[model samples]
Target chain A: MTETPTSSHFKENAHAALHDAPLQKALQHVRVNFIDKRAKAVARLPEFEALRDSARDIKDHTLANLDLYIEAYEARVVAAGGHVHYAMTAKDGVDIVLKLCHERGAKAVTKGKSMIAEEMGLNAALEAAGIDPIETDLGEYIIQLRGEAPSHIIAPAVHLNKEQVEADFRRVHRDLPSDRDLSQPVQLLTEARGILRDKFLSADIGVTGANFLIAETGTSIIVTNEGNGDLTQILPKVHIVLASLEKIVPTLEDASQLLRVLARSATGQDMSVYTTLSTGPRRPGDPDGPEEYHVILIDNGRSSMLGGDFEDMLRCIRCGACMNHCPIYHAVGGHAYGSVYPGPMGAVLTPSLIGVEEGGQLPNASTFCGRCEAVCPVRIPLPNMMRHWREREFERHLSPKAMRYGIGFWAFFAKRPTLYRLSTNVAMRALHWLGRAKGRFASLPFAGGWTRYRDLPAPQGATFQSQWRAKSGSVH
Target chain B: MSAREEILANIRRSLGVTGAEAPRRMAVDDRLAQARSGIIPQRGQGDQAARVATFKDEAERAQASVVEVETAADAPGEIARFLRDSNLPATLRMGDDPRLAAMPWSATALDTAHGASDGHDLNAVSAAFAAIAESGTLALVSGPDNPTTLNFLPDNHFVVVAASDIVGDYESVWRKLRGGYGKGAMPRTVNFITGPSRSADIEQTLLLGAHGPRRLHIVIVKGA
Candidate 1:
């Protein structure tokens, strides 16, 4: 995790990503793989849609009574022989973790993939504190080697091909033979598995993120396709779960409702290979499990999201279906978004977490395709929240001067019907006559943004209003 | 104020609620106590035979090999034959589960080791607490009976699930947990495993056996 977010320069980053040959080639895998798998998985279960509605209701109930749930959840954790630490900010969360690591005299820590850690820059903070943080997830390990952020939430190395990973392994694992046949993906996987196994055994502290925290059972659950998260939590003497306070559900049954849709929407599996529920430290007679359990509940601006316009965004399970189906995300890839999260969900969430001024460029990244809403298991209305962000940006004058001026100009004509019709009528005929030769605008004044990428069709002699009026009687 | 109090205060403020509201507290208490289940898929419903069939089909679809045995005593020989056929090692590690301990391991020539693994073992087996047919998931709880380490550390994993323990959905397994472990008290770990470990991290080309068990073999015991 890094402290800097290049979200303000999203336009420039996108510009660079559009032309990056290797990145464009890598993004093809995402466009082809995730969407089809999720579709097939959803089609198999008739209860999938009903389960989604149930999941949404469960989250909405929990959020409304969040304070009480947190109280109950804390009581359970404390009773189950685990410690609960509350962090009001990401910095506080990092300090809490660092303190815990220092208390244990930890040198090496094996970490499962956690977006909360990515948001808080936990790895960099750990490294700065002279602790080695080893990423256990194959995708996470690959990205960590390249010193890059994850392009997709679930598929962190989706922006990389097998060749990039092969090179990274060869560069870092210098002790291995140079002529090793790392041609296939499986060979690369096997190589990383062998390397990480030793680290898993040696690491003193294991860190992971929880998909859900059940208040009734006092359990923190992780749903992973790979069993890395389980190994990370189970092996070490100290297991630390880094989670947001909003992840709590009231009961195991409620978690079941959410779990039903989680894997299908994310990886298109009936169930992920491993869905582990870790309650607390090991029992008295238990042989091989963590000796201590700790949960760092980080708020980092999510509490204020309650009862607000962006409250629905809190319902997201981070399944990554939104990005998989996004047209803009397909074109530019995740690095271009310049945030830990990418795609439509990121567009709404980044602004909330990082402030509208820095992350305002992201909300405008959507084409309003609405596939994200349709496919969302909990049914978060992403496009509407992006619209809310746009309004906030416009009101605060955080949007570009040209966009503001253009919107203002349109608003002026929009308010007065007579003037609007008159201007549109005159402008339409002029454009019709001027562009009659080519019949399209390859380049135009004040429309460079649109025409630069693709041509805008010229007006067909008359405006839509005039054409509508002429066809009104006959059509009726 | 302490961090916990401050965070709680912030949440209550945003939610426009007093922390001690009676109705809200009641609602939360009722929800937790009731622990009502939501939608459950109908595919895995019916008698034990139907559930076992659905479980096998779904498990195989997830790339886990499943075999049926008439009794718990028959599991070891079947697993040994599977190991011999697959060209795997004759040795395997496991935890000290009583059901597995009751099995006649000496009947077969397969060398069996007990206790938790330290990552050197190639293959291991554990008796599952329950199995869900909806997604072909085996629910294994953690303790000395069947240590959680045996589930993840080894390259190859064999889980012996009871046919009677196979339920139609995840909710059924939750009820069984409540019945067995008591309300609000559960094992340190309950792992629901569906297939062998796999990763699509490298260019979305899925390759099994990333970090956990490379091969997951399930043996369903029909009856006592």
Candidate 2:
């Protein structure tokens, strides 16, 4: 199992991942699938562009008036006999959940895939309190068993191949026959089911994340391919929902707008296998739902983004479509960023949520390819967001002095035409003189990172400006 | 101050946006027209029938168990027969559908029938007013009569859908809902169910019945 990566450990892990050919191949396949399928899905819909625009507008409007909708949602939930709790931070969210567990005396927790829970680090907290928090989502459970964080947003275990998974299952489930053929997806699933069935039955509490929180009804909508979320929320005595404050949509109809695009963009499916809406807790006379329901609305740095240019980032549905299409992401993958969220959306979101001090390097990983923006269902300007973070990193003095000086020197000369031309002329002549038989630089000074990966093509004789001037026979 | 008042005050202070006046006596009937207008770009002819067809096709595509019947009276017997086949018990919680309430279900009762208000009925038989075919989703509304409990509390959930209530896509469904509920209108809750309650939470293995019903059954009532 891969160890949980820390800031100090990320560089080495990234180096290893970058060099791994099989990992690269797997990522390339995923990138093609996500981009190609999304393109096809969007092509069939004549009004897709219009729909995306409307979805973006709706989310923006909803977030701007989130206070009203949250109140409306609370009123609806209360009327439906559900309880609501507002949590101001990650710790606050965890505390609310822990309190609910304490009150219910919950011994075990079955959970659906909620990134918010991951953000709060709820599993560790729950385990510390002697309550076993079991991740019910197949991908989430696999990583949880290995004691690792999810590398990708959509497919948490995207980094792992079947062989690694087989090893994980063997290590975790010792009772299984040693000779069991675990290479096939079906066999792995069968073994997992046998073990998880007991956990589901025994769990005292169920926790889930909401895709959308309908303020009008105090209800949450959870979309999943597997049934884990339903079980996580329904079977246990106490049901706790962890959601970010920005998840609120004004009405079910609004939620519908987002749902139309979510599945098509994420998996190229008309819809996921299951989309369940939960309201409060089980009402009187109901047979099987939890007796108690608690909604822990978290505001972990989300409120700070409101009414700002970066506010559009909140519209993200965590679909992973952006990362799937991004060239930079395809090359580096999720682990390189050293954060929970990876890829284009990660590059934008992690810095905002975790602060620039921790995740400042993420934004710089991008080449501003704009593929992320093209694939984003909600149409977030990812490159612009990265630029904003870059600015923030510079202001915070988080950037290296060498990088700062280099950028500063470039900017200084670029503003002066004479100096810019002089520098370009000198650089072009030097590059031309160094150009070898193959017309590529195998090794070069000042461009170590670039040269390390592949040979840099020798500069074509003169600068573009110089060539253009000469072509026009107007060189001064 | 009460929780509502305190919450409102806190929100007012935080949002820095003045709270709009609550419209008194905003009747459902008046709002429905406004809601509908906002939802549909152009009032398409045969919207209802088209919507219903959309729902039916979506249900069929998703591999959901859908059966069409002529009348609501036929629902209990058909649903009961389905449960028997699936080996699920007949004991069911009921949603507030006037037709379902009026049905002579004692004649169709596979085991027992309980209203939405009945707290003990875990295996539920309910009715969805409409479904979206594009995504194979069933939409449910919660109200005084149609309590959300009946649909959720059960281990086996059975939904009786009217074929005429089916719609083509999520956009159309949104239009119907928006048209049904005008701006600022909030239902107690609306559920869009695609399939049975499921989770892949435990080792990425897909498991049914993690928190909600292990099974979901849909019976479509046609020409009712």
lDDT of all predictions: 0.93, 0.72
Q: Write the per-residue lDDT of candidate 1 for residues B55-127, one digit (tens) a residue.
A: 9999999999999999999999998999999999999898889989999899998999989899999989999
Worst 10 residues of 1 chain B by lDDT: B142-151
User: If you score just chain A, what TM-score does every candidate get?
Assistant: 0.98, 0.94
Q: Please identify model 1 stretches exceeding 4 Å from their true place.
A: A473-476
Q: On residues A111-183, what C-alpha lDDT tens digit does candidate 1 reach at each position?
A: 9999999999999999999999999999999999988888899999999988988999999999999999999
* Candidate 2 chain A lowest-lDDT run of ten: A1-10
Give per-model CA RMSD.
1.1, 5.4
Local error of candidate 2 at residue A226 (angstroms): 1.2
CAPRI quality level assigned to candidate 1 from its DockQ score: high
Q: In angstroms, what RMSD does candidate 2 have relative to the true structure?
A: 5.4
Give the TM-score of each candidate. 0.99, 0.82
Over the full model, what C-alpha lDDT does candidate 2 score relative to the true structure?
0.72
